[model samples]
Target chain A: MKHNFGAGPCILPQEVFKQASHGVLNFNNTGLSILEISHRAPEFVAVMDEAISLVKELLNVPEGYSVLFLQGGASLQFAMTAYNLLPEDKKAVFLETGVWAKKAFAEANLIGNAEVIASSKDKNYSYIPKDYTVNADSAYFHCTSNNTIYGTQMHSFPQTPVGKVCDMSSDIFSRVINVADFDLIYAGAQKNIGPAGATVVIVKDEILGKSGRKIPSMLDYQKQIDAVSMYNTPPVFSVYTAMLNLRWLKAKGGVAEIEKENNEKAKALYAEIDRNPLFKGTAAVEDRSKMSVCFVMENPDLEKPFLKFAEEKGCVGIKGHRSVGGFRASLYNALPITSVHALVEAMQEFAEKNV
Target chain B: MKHNFGAGPCILPQEVFKQASHGVLNFNNTGLSILEISHRAPEFVAVMDEAISLVKELLNVPEGYSVLFLQGGASLQFAMTAYNLLPEDKKAVFLETGVWAKKAFAEANLIGNAEVIASSKDKNYSYIPKDYTVNADSAYFHCTSNNTIYGTQMHSFPQTPVGKVCDMSSDIFSRVINVADFDLIYAGAQKNIGPAGATVVIVKDEILGKSGRKIPSMLDYQKQIDAVSMYNTPPVFSVYTAMLNLRWLKAKGGVAEIEKENNEKAKALYAEIDRNPLFKGTAAVEDRSKMSVCFVMENPDLEKPFLKFAEEKGCVGIKGHRSVGGFRASLYNALPITSVHALVEAMQEFAEKNV
Candidate 1:
């Protein structure tokens, strides 16, 4: 009866959860918990191998791309991407759209010279910047595909003269994109994929080993690619859960079919928010995130009652972020239409009662 | 019936796995997968808070110490610890015991000036270096509590004139230790705790803020400690499983009782290895790791058949690392006495036939 709409570490398919739970107990009928298995074992290696292959298959990634399941989440990638890609005297360009982008900028600044090509920070990051010029000889153009807290998304990708890398932590696999356009894409699996602890990095093989800096073995993308993501002990349980989630994604007719469902769900919720007088949407209409619908009520006092009512009606995690107080309904890929409908009904009832 | 002795991303308790699996499906009866919940949510905050509290209580950690559940395994800590604790001007003293300690030393060398106080590398790291001089004004003295690959342990901790830090990745909570002795302690949860993806960091509050170097938020132990390990999205499932494992440890009379059991298991396995003429123990008698027992046959060519026979007899993951070839029986906390008995029986049979 309950719906989960919390942002990243957001909703995952029920079947994925069920299968993942089963694996923890008896992984491939090994009588050992998935935690107990060796990453080097043929069984676990197969799991990593298939997980990477499926990621490539689902995204239509080209042959040269190598997928790595790393520890430390996408936040680590903020440092790693810059550390591996940014050359000694050159700088990287970053488009700051939201909290994640800002974090990436800070990490890049720490390691090497980074220029903010454009930023929506002046407007509290309510919209993604448009038509920013990327340096032709720069290391890469970094962007965040979706902003979870700000409820903003890049409607279209930036035209990068150099290699393009994205922190798709929040919006990976929600829709199809031209995989060829990106040289690197990293996502923390807590959002649309599986659990925390694993971050997926799909990097073009050729773009690696160009960084003159002596990268640590763990931080080196090329080292990880050569070992096939088993350079160090990988997050085995998380990877397995991701595989199950990917299986669920594939079963529901892949990204194209899921995109339709996602669009429909977002449309239903956004329609309710736009029509409702008591509530006001937070992000710019042109750049609003389909995955996360952020809004606030007219009366600040009504926020508590609205959230309480929503919770009582089995609509959970509707409260917005503290920085931008309101309500955010995260309609991730696994969030069913029924849940979105339930949220819409709650919003309507709240609007009528308050008005 | 399969035994998992793979060093890290290692074995976990069956009951812990059961409870964790259930939590992933319906965390705290909220009808949401643990993956779906917000990290800032009161429910998850409570989970992390309790996990930290349990760590303190179980280890009898002092009041000044803060516990953090971070991503990036113990490997990351090598760089982070050096970056956080060491100033650019002063050298950090390192005690190189095995492959892990060597890695730690290498990472420290990359970041700042580090002095190798003593190293067992000359002796192939068979034993711990003893009677080493401590650098008085060094940033901190670093050592590995248990060497996973070489199967060696620092039975008695070194007396450091400077602050002490230990990478307790392999043998954390295996025995009672004076937590106050070290300024910091870090362990990758894969081995003894629950699963991969989460690393446990215990740091004294007073020892921080010394390094003038600007550390990236993720690498800064102080930032993690300040946010109470919520600086970034933590490895939720791993932390929850660790909580379950800690509860299991508590129910079984805490570390004291577990240590006794561990010692007995190690004794049984080591005795068999010593008595068997066909097999030779890899580590020194006094420095042997209670967690991992490395051994090799008189005829190294017999390794394949020995491993096959062991696998057939339900002794799995016994093959040693390629760097240090042979067999290793990783007797982690969750490894049952029955499993060790089974391994010993297999080894005896192999010795009888092969010799």
Candidate 2:
């Protein structure tokens, strides 16, 4: 009955969890934990192949794109993309929307020069910036698709003159998008996909080998592609769970159908925040994330009691991030509409009791 | 009845896998996929704390040593260790034993000046080199504790005038060792531990912050130690499985007991290979790895049928590395004596048939 709103590593379908749990005991009836199997073994290779293939199909990736399941999460990709793509003395453009974008920029700056094309940081990143021009000569333009902490999202993606890479860690597979527009897209699996160990990276095959730098094998996309994501030992259990989750998504009519349900869930919760006198939404209306809804109380002292009341009513993980205090109800792909409805009801009860 | 002898992502104790399976579905009865829990949440933080604490106890790690569970496997550590510890002006000493050692040297050479003080490659790395001298002012000395491809091991660790680091990727936790001998040690979890995504790094705190070179946050040992491995989203499921495996290791008596079993298994298998006229052990007796036993036929043409025959007799993953063709039997902590007996019997039958 409890609603999970904790962001990234947040929530997953019950059926996906069940199937993944069984994989740890016996994967493909091999009588071995998926963790115990070799990544190169035909049995595990089949699992890896299907996971990558399904992601391409589910996301409707273009023909030239190759999907890679890598370790080190999105944080590592921030450095890897910059190291592998940025030309020796040139730069890359970045849109600093929130924590993730800032991190990407920071890494790019450390490895090579990078310009901040636009930034919403001046206003505490409550909205995504607009009307920024990407330099055609730059290596690639990078931006975060969804900000987990501030509950802000890029409602419309930027048109990059250069190649485009999106850190879709929080909102991947939640909606259908033109995969061909992006040169590279990377997402940590904990949020909308499956688990913490794996990060899904889809890259256009032709976009590689441009940077003259001798990129380390682990960070090099070409090396990863050549080895079939088996250049080294992979996060086997995490990858298997991701496959299970993708299967669940396919069963539920893929991303297009899931997007509708997600939109409705966000609307129900956002409507309650708007209607209630005691709470106020945090992010800009147009830029607010459908995945994570951040809101603060009109009466600051009521925050603790409101959280307590919500917890008592079986709504959990509603406390906002410490940096931006209030409440954040993360409505991810797996969060049921019933959970969003329950949160709305709790908000109504709290407003009635307080005001 | 099947024996799994794959080098890594290898066998794990059945009990560990069983317990880990349950946690994936409902971690600690919290109705959350272990994959879905935030690394900073109390539930997962507790898991991380326990895993680190258990590793400390089981390894008898000193107070000054900090244990960190990281991503990118041992491959990433090759570059990270050099970047973090190797000073700009001085060369780090490396002992080239096999494929992994060569990889470490290549990465180090790319980052800074590196010296290969000794090499076994002249003999195709069939033996570990001896009578090598360590530089007095070298940044650090690096060696692979066990060679996965050639099945050779450093029977006794090197005594260096400077700090020492060992890439114990394939042989860590198989036996007790003097922790004081090395300033840092790293191992991929897939082999002797639980799974692949997590890498265990134990560092002596005093040896850090010396390099003055700017290390990316992910590669900095101090940054990870400061955050207690929560600097970024961790491989939660993998670490949890490692904890389960560690718990199993403790329940059956720690590394000391596991070492005894490992030794016995290796001895039985090697005896069969040595006594059989048709087969020949690959590595020199003095340098042979207790974990991985590499062998091939006196005549190379019999390799294919020998592998097929072994596989048919319920022995899996016994194929040798392409670099060194023949067969490899990886006897890790979780690999029981019975499996080794099964492999030994299969080898005996194959030898009789070939003769």
Candidate 3:
């Protein structure tokens, strides 16, 4: 079997894929493909409802927060967070983490005044910036919880005076966090949730309607939540498959259990990276992400050769992003520990060849 | 055995569903689910490219026009159209024919000066408003090509003094149209295109980059086109399935052929509605949608029984919209003429009982 280690829109449990594939043919045996069913139909509506409810249950979302399944990935969320939460006169504060973080800040600044209080870009974002303080006057404190490119993750969020907004796109369900800790947590469903279409947003009800801008109905969080996340015909199959995937997650004992698996997967891969003579981890040891385990061969010229070696062993998508220039094995929740073991073995076999 | 007449996220070719289902489990036999592949991966990039190329070919989209597969459906396009086209000072005019038209004009007005140059709301949208002059000073004139709620359509578009924009949400790809006639033509894929998660936007390149407002990247057509519609991670399966559906359309001899079939389906059903003594057509005869055929019973109390009757005979989703208070049988492209014949037979049977 091919071990898929591609970043976001990566691996999902095979059972979920089977169910989703079956759904595309005959959903709920209604003799209708999920792709063709009306969102208003009771069958699909129940799927949407379950998708939303599962997010709340899986995260233990508190009473005052609302969970939304929306279109437009984290890219759109970058601007939407500013439009709904940042007023014309307000300054939105940000932690500059990686390319996504930079883009998030740039988009927010395009709509309103956005300031970066701290950055790890000086060292190619190998670690999280921890020294600077968020301004109390800022509209909101925005941060990217995980940098997929550099494989850095903020293990703990900073407490801020204003609202806290985090883009948890790459690492959302891999670990558990207190829902009430942040004012908003948005994740593109691709990585840990389900697929690439639906984006999951959990927001505190009270933080909305404060932007004072006449936001479009599609971009306004309050209106979307008011419509009960059926704001527009949501990504139907995405939501349905997401529900199926979440059901799988629930059956596998939710985030805590998945987090344990994710840790072991990352530990096994990183341990090999550290122990192997030809390789080394890329990110700062403390801030390295559990979701995306990025590393490089010590001998730069050997990188391409090792990539081919890994591919021959059916270790797919092990090549690193161009920006990072090494390797990124995304240990997402759905990737089995066996895949990590396989990657580790390949690395060991390759190291023996080189040494 | 089932005839689906649901307005949107409606019927698509059964073979397309089969292919789409296969793609989900083992996309191109890559041993990976379609949901797990990276949008940037070569295999998926090919899928995205083919999806765009198919739109251009099927629509005969000339040079200087960009075809985009975007998320957020037509609702977001309502605002995006104005955001990218309507200047702060210039007015955007609209022909308000139905609820969708009214919402489109309303959304445009929210961003800039907008006016409804004509409206059919006075008659409960029973007809398309034909008499109105679009101001030469208006930035662009917008119209809904098909009204799903009221079952009204603009068979022939108005020649506007300025740029012409159309929301062809419900009836795109059912018939052929000159892409040069409109500056922008957008449709939610659910009805006739593919599925709910993706929207198709065909825009003339010359009409862009003049709005003067700093539109956000996701809503800005120029930016999206520049990015080749990969502005964000697209709705993967929706676009993939859309490609398959479009391929089906092409193999069935393209839009001209489908238009003939669509015309025949509308003709057969409308003839039955007019001939049946117990029922009558809802929209004006000249303006009745060839896609959504709406009719009401002569005796209103029998509506529920007729719906029940239709469903019992394996005719599904024939229930009309709440506001219309009648039956709306949407004859989207994927719906076979045989299904129409089946529905007509049911209507005839129901009329005999009522009489």
Candidate 4:
């Protein structure tokens, strides 16, 4: 079997994939394909309900928080969240860590006003910015929990003066976090969750409907919440696959147990990068993401050779972001620790042969 | 065998469903599920490419038109189309035929200036409004070709002074239409296409990039076309299923052959509605939709019993839209004429027993 570590649209548990595939063929043995079933049907509605409730239970979400399965991914939410939350007079505070954070900031700025409280751009986003002051007049503080590109993650979420919004696109359900700490959270459900079709949004009910803009009905948070995420025939197949994946996550002891295994996998790869003579970890020591372990060849000349060696050993998707141009071993919740071991051994063997 | 006549999120061919289900489990025998594959990967890129090509081939899309598979359904396109085409100085001309047209006009009004040249709302949208003039300064003329709620359709598309945009959400692929006649066309895929997650947008390249508005990247037609609809991770499963359905459409002799069948199905049902003394059609004779055939019990008291009778006879989803409070039989391309015969038989049997 080949090992998969691609970032976002990445690997999923085999059981989840199998069950999802089975549903596609004959959901509940109704003799009707999931692709053909109406979303308004009681069967699919139950799927949506269970998916929402599972997300709440797994995250230990507060009573007032509502989870939504929406389209347009986290990139759209970069503006949609602002459209629903930020008024014309207020600015949003953003912590700029990498490419995704900058994109988020840009989209928010396009909609209205946004301020980058702090940025690590001086170092190509190798570290997380700290000690940034949240503006009192800000509508929300938006941050990316894990930088899929730079391999950095915020270990401690920043508290904002007015409200907090986090883009957990690459790291939701990978670890445990207090859902009560943030007013809103959105994640593109391709990494650490299910597929790429649906984006999951969890928000505190009290924080919505504050913006003065005439929000488009599809982008309006209040409209989605009122409709129970059934607003306009939600991405049914995507939501159903997400439900299956969430069920799989719950069966494996939820996020807490998944987090422990994730940490061990990250630790294994980072240790190899440290001990191997030809390899080096990329991100700042403490800020490195447990979900995405990035590293590079010390000589740069060995990059191609190491990649070739790893690929020959059935290790797939170890290529790093094009901007980074090294290697990123995304240790998402579904990736087996054995795959990390295989990569580590391959790296050591390549070093022994070349260096 | 149950007969599915749901308005949308409706039925698809059994062959397409089976093939889609198989792909979900093992896409191309790569041992990786379609949900797990990256959109940029050759496997899924081929999927997107084939899907676009099939749509083009089926519609006989001209060289200047580009087909894009986008998210956020046609409702988002209600604003997005206006955002991209309607300028501050010019108003969009809309021909209001039914609920969908009015909703489209309202959304365009929210974005910029949009005026309804004519409307059939005075008669509960029983017929299409002709003799509407497209203003000289109009940015574009918009219309809903098939009114899903009212069960009416445009027998002939209105010629406009400026550009033309149509939301053909319910009846897109069921019949053939000249692609060169319209500047832009969009449809939510839940109806005649595939599932609910994706929307198909076919736009004339020359018409875009003219609107003077800061369009959100997700909503910008030019940006989506430039990126070849991979601007973001698309609804992979939705696109995949649509591709399967489109493939089935082409193999079964494309839209031309399907239209003949659709017309026959509509004819059979409408003939029954006309012949039966207990039933009456809601839409005007010339404007009645071939895709959605709506009828009501003439006695009014027979509605409940007829519905129960039909349900007991394996007829599902015959309930009409709540707004109309009657029975609607949606004869999508995937639905066989035999199902329509079954529906007609059920109606005749019910009328005999009740009379």
| Residue B256 in candidate 3, Cα distance off native in Å | 0.1
**What does candidate 1's lDDT look like per residue over A103-138, in tens digits?**
998898898899898999989889888967886888
What lDDT score is found at residue A233 in candidate 3? 89
Model 3 ranges off by over 4 Å: none
Report residue A162 deviation for candidate 2 (angstroms): 2.3
The positional error of residue A99 in candidate 1, measured at the CA in angstroms, is: 2.1
Per-residue alpha-carbon lDDT of model 2 for B253-313, expressed as tens digits?
9999999998899889889888988888999999999998999999889989989998899
Worst 10 residues of 1 chain B by lDDT: B1-10
Q: A-chain TM-score per prediction?
A: 0.98, 0.98, 0.99, 0.99
TM-scores of the candidates are 0.95, 0.97, 0.99, 0.97
User: In terms of TM-score, how similar is model 2 to the real structure?
Assistant: 0.97
How would you encode candidate 4's per-residue C-alpha lDDT over B198-308 as one tens digit per residue?
999999999888888887888888889889899889888889999999999999999999999999999999999999999999999999999988889888888988898
Best candidate (score: DockQ): 3
Comparing to the true complex, what docking class would candidate 4 get?
A: medium
Between candidates 1 and 3, name the one with more favorable DockQ.
Answer: 3
TM-score of chain B of each: 0.97, 0.98, 0.99, 0.99
Q: Is candidate 1 or candidate 2 better by lDDT?
A: 2
lDDT of 4 by residue, A114-190 (tens): 99989999988999998778878788898999998899999998666778899999999999999999999999989
User: What are the DockQ scores of the candidates, in order?
Assistant: 0.69, 0.74, 0.85, 0.72
**Candidate 2 lDDT score at position B106:** 89
- Alpha-carbon deviation at B243 in model 1, angstroms: 1.0
